[model samples]
Target chain A: NAGVTQTPKFRILKIGQSMTLQCTQDMNHNYMYWYRQDPGMGLKLIYYSVGAGITDKGEVPNGYNVSRSTTEDFPLRLELAAPSQTSVYFCASSYGVGGKAFFGQGTRLTVV
Target chain B: AQTVTQSQPEMSVQEAETVTLSCTYDTSESDYYLFWYKQPPSRQMILVIRQEAYKQQNATENRFSVNFQKAAKSFSLKISDSQLGDAAMYFCAPAFFNAGGTSYGKLTFGQGTILTVHP
Candidate 1:
């Protein structure tokens, strides 16, 4: 089972371009999250969803949007990619509070 | 807000030796959870070990173990018989359960510690 999967392993975008990072899990977890990892920095939560039709902003949610229409997927959207948005993005899911989290391989994005 | 701290930014240990990575957290809630995640060059975050706040006994997984001191808010990872594959970035993360103002399953992570295993 692919616990969690993220698409577009690597991508480069222009300043005003827009894109979406797709994440899906097969574990049927109700809690899903999107995080960004900068060099030498730990992962920073961007957005999270407790279940379908529910989403909340995390520590760093500027310049990003997310949706949870289903339990298996949580996609992150970048409206206007900026240099500051360039970082490695990771998607994770968990069974519930205090449960173990499963992370995807990660997607590396760069904006010039 | 909860926060995790990893004082050691980088460390090196010889192969087959024992090494410890330190971690500390700040939380007002009495019951929570702590975890250690390892990220290799492959960039996949792998769960190494976990500790529950109410469990006095430390958590252990084969060669990996955690020393959880709830009162002091310290949770450290100990690696025995370290191998080359252990060379990677280690993150200390903590989460609260059913905290009134917090989102469920959200984690607070430290800056991370880079471990180098010398052969």
Candidate 2:
């Protein structure tokens, strides 16, 4: 089974451009999250959703947005991308908050 | 707010040898969870092991084991018989409750410790 899937394994965007990082999970989990990892750094939370239609901002939510329309999908949107937004983005899902999370392979985004 | 710390930015170990990565955290919550996730060159975050604050017994998975010191709020990972595949960036994460009753499931991650296995 495909535990977690992230589309566009790699992408490049010019400054002020916008794009969406798609993430879907087959585990039927209730919790989903978006995180970005800079080189040699740990993952930083960008957004999270406890369940469908319930989303919240995270530590690094300045240039990102997220929506959870269904239990299977949680997509992250990067608007007006900046150089600081260039990093590897990851999507994760968990049965619930504080539960073990299954992470996606990651999408490497570069903003020029 | 909770914070996780990994003081070691990099660590090296001879193949077949054992290495320990240290982690410390700060949190007021009495019940929570700690985890070690490994991100290899593939850039996939994989769960190495996990420990629940309320559980006295440490968690172990295959060649990986954790030393959980609740009082000190420290969680260290020990890898036995280190293999080339074990070389990766290790992150210590602590999960805690937010102001809202809903669980954050959000993780406070450390700066990350890079493990290098030398043959």
Candidate 3:
């Protein structure tokens, strides 16, 4: 169904390097979210977008940024990667408030 | 601010038996939603069940069910007839609506409980 697609399923970034994580959903959902999962830990919110042109920071948005220029695409940007940033990134989307969220397979990132 | 807590970090159950994962949350809002998400080794986060605070009846999906205690602020997931496929990490997540009800997707997740089914 191509519910939520995240590119670069696995990535290795050198310290201080920058990269963008791409996420797209074909469900035409209004709410999109970015989250990171550390090893043996729960998911933490990174960034979220309510709609096109509307974005907000989540619990752990320090080293990340996101933009939602279109309804289907929400990309997270890392300006200067650090070893702590190494984790699995997930993208999710929902129809609206009180709706079920569908998550992507996730992007496993490692910083050296 | 709202918080969710899953006390059991790891649990094991024999196949064909049942297991219950505990979760507790603290929230002042009267209206909210609770969800149980299962993340298998495949790393796919799947929604197991959901419960609304306003609803008095518990929510059930096939072999998965939830015991939602609004007053106590507890939401737990019970897996009946545990199978090897049921082994996974279960996360208890709660979503609260802002005053305007504009945020339908913001979620606070508990640490999660790892379920192991012994065949």
**Ordering by lDDT:** 1, 3, 2
lDDT of 3 by residue, B76-115 (tens): 8999999999999999999888676555548788999999
lDDT tens digits, residue span A1-112, model 1? 8899999899999999999999999999999999999988999999999999999999999999999999989999999999999999999999888889999999999999
For every model shown, the clashing-pair count is 0, 0, 1
Please list, in the order the candidates appear, how each scores on TM-score for chain B only.
0.94, 0.93, 0.94
lDDT of 3 by residue, A16-109 (tens): 9999999999999999999999999899999989899999888899999899999999999998999999999999998877689999999999
lDDT scores of the candidates, listed in order: 0.92, 0.90, 0.91
What are the DockQ scores of the candidates, in order?
0.85, 0.80, 0.74
Q: State the lDDT at B32 in candidate 2.
A: 77
Candidate 1 lDDT score relative to the true structure: 0.92
Error of 2 at A47 (Å): 0.5
Best lDDT among the predictions, by candidate number: 1
| Model 3 chain A poorest ten-residue lDDT run | A92-101
RMSD of each: 1.1, 1.4, 1.0
Q: Could you arrange the candidates by DockQ from highest to lowest?
A: 1, 2, 3
Mind giving the per-residue lDDT tens digits that candidate 1 earns over B8-110?
9999999999999999988776568889999999999999998888889999999999999887989999999999999999999998655574647588899
